[model samples]
Target: MNNGWFYTAEFRDGRFTQIQWQRSGQPPQTTTLTFSSTNGQGQPIYTGAFQAATAVTLVDLSGGNVQPGSQVSVEVEEWGWARGNCRR
Candidate 1:
């Protein structure tokens, strides 16, 4: 079943980045974060920030899944920043 767990990061500078649905109870995985802008038509314009940016780390915590009573938490951290198209 899809746990529908996702990680999202919003920069104070107005950037929204989201990671795909990740399964719980699994080892941590490295995912790339990205930013984009909107065109005049109001469509998302994506750009690659793999070079200038650092890596994003995601951690899964055991919760509600182990014992009868428990909780799960997701952690996220930003490695670095990338310069290019700003978020709109």
Candidate 2:
């Protein structure tokens, strides 16, 4: 089977957030995933909730403000399989 995933990030109100991951066609039966964020120091910052859906939204709560040239990145991964991995 061909597994696929998508992710996106956005900044609003000086906070970093994710829009959601939309599946290509249909949703998965057993969808298990996790979300996390960190700072430039590679420290664990924020962790998001998991759900069963084609997409998910993430939020960064590092208590830092996001500027226009702020260097922020996000990562998404799929559990039990090594297919869905995103960074931005």
Candidate 3:
């Protein structure tokens, strides 16, 4: 099952947030994800909400502003997992 188990969200300012997940056949969930690190531009990244769904994963971004023409980098983390059997 491919499940799209891993996700990486890139910021416009060249910073990225990544998440790893697993499912145990339970239900959908929504949680707040905070970035404890800064981007390549030396600015603190913002916090966002992560929602695990069947059709597609959703990320609601809040805070942090980026400037133009900057390079981006990604930081991956094995945060946690989601449990669900949602058909949709």
Candidate 4:
């Protein structure tokens, strides 16, 4: 069983790259973490929601089509676990 107290995740071009976390009461840390390397490709529908996510596919919202440097940043608010995307 793999486990860690993860607080944040980072990605580059749709690839799972790193995580910010802490091990119990220890100091929080930012460390390299990758649970997948397939670029999150494959079937879209996942039958299991409670199960850990095996993949994530990032897309380009640039209208033309998904291409290099086309990914955009999305701001999410977890305050009270209920909020919408906050764009500036």
Candidate 5:
């Protein structure tokens, strides 16, 4: 995540589901997810609700091609009070 959230790259059924996010003490919640593209299997453009603190998954694909400092971006509405963008 752009907020520096470290996430796993796998999900149940063995698919690379999402770039998941979750903060300590906060239970995972669901939100709508949008994917830019599908994998080589041709899953197709996907949009659906998922569970996590703030999931930014690619739905049913791998992020193996995504490198650090890549152009991929994450948008946050507003960092909570005392949580500056560069701070955490």
Candidate 6:
């Protein structure tokens, strides 16, 4: 329960865009959160989705590295993607 890094989200077009994270020493980071409603004087402001998520920790990379607990798995998918919407 020490090693870290484990991000995974792969929803395209309408959302998620892309998110990836791997950890062994760190050097695998990606950010791509897509979804827009416009609001800074543009108008319309509510049309993003993704309403559920749980905890995760599974890992296995072997040759490339990263090997945490063999394989438990529970990261349904996430890079936050603004996580369930909340902007003010």
Q: Best-fitting candidate, measured by TM-score?
A: 2
Considering lDDT, where higher is better, how would the candidates rank from best to worst? 2, 5, 3, 6, 1, 4
Of the candidates numbered 2 and 4, which has the greater TM-score value? Answer: 2
Per-residue lDDT of model 2, residues 1-88, tens digit only: 1245544444445444434445678563322323355557543343343363333323343335443343333333443222222242
Q: 1-88 in candidate 6: lDDT tens per residue?
A: 1236555644433233444657788677654444334445432222222222333322121211223332212223354222221111
What's the TM-score of every candidate structure? Answer: 0.29, 0.39, 0.24, 0.30, 0.30, 0.22
lDDT of 5 at 18: 43
Per-residue lDDT of model 3, residues 1-88, tens digit only: 2344433333433333433333566444433345555546455543444454333222222224333333223222343333222111
Q: Candidate 5 on 13-67: residue-level lDDT in tens?
A: 3333443456666665444445457657654333333343422334332243433
Alpha carbon lDDT at 68, candidate 6: 35
Name the better of 4 and 5 by TM-score: 5
- Which window of 10 residues has the lowest lDDT sum in candidate 6? 57-66
The digit string of per-residue lDDT tens for model 4 on 4-71 reads 33334444563435444446876775444433222243311111111133322222233323344543
Better of 2 and 5 by TM-score: 2
* Deviation from native of the Cα of residue 38 in model 5, angstroms: 14
Q: lDDT per residue, candidate 1, 42-82, as tens digits? A: 43333333223533332212211222222222233242322
Backbone clashes in model 2, listed as residue pairs: 21-55
Stretches off by above 4 angstroms in model 3 are 5-26, 46-63, 66-88
> For model 6, what is the alpha-carbon lDDT of residue 2?
26
TM-score of 4: 0.30
For model 2, how big is the CA root-mean-square deviation? 7.3
Model 5: per-residue Cα lDDT at residue 16 = 33
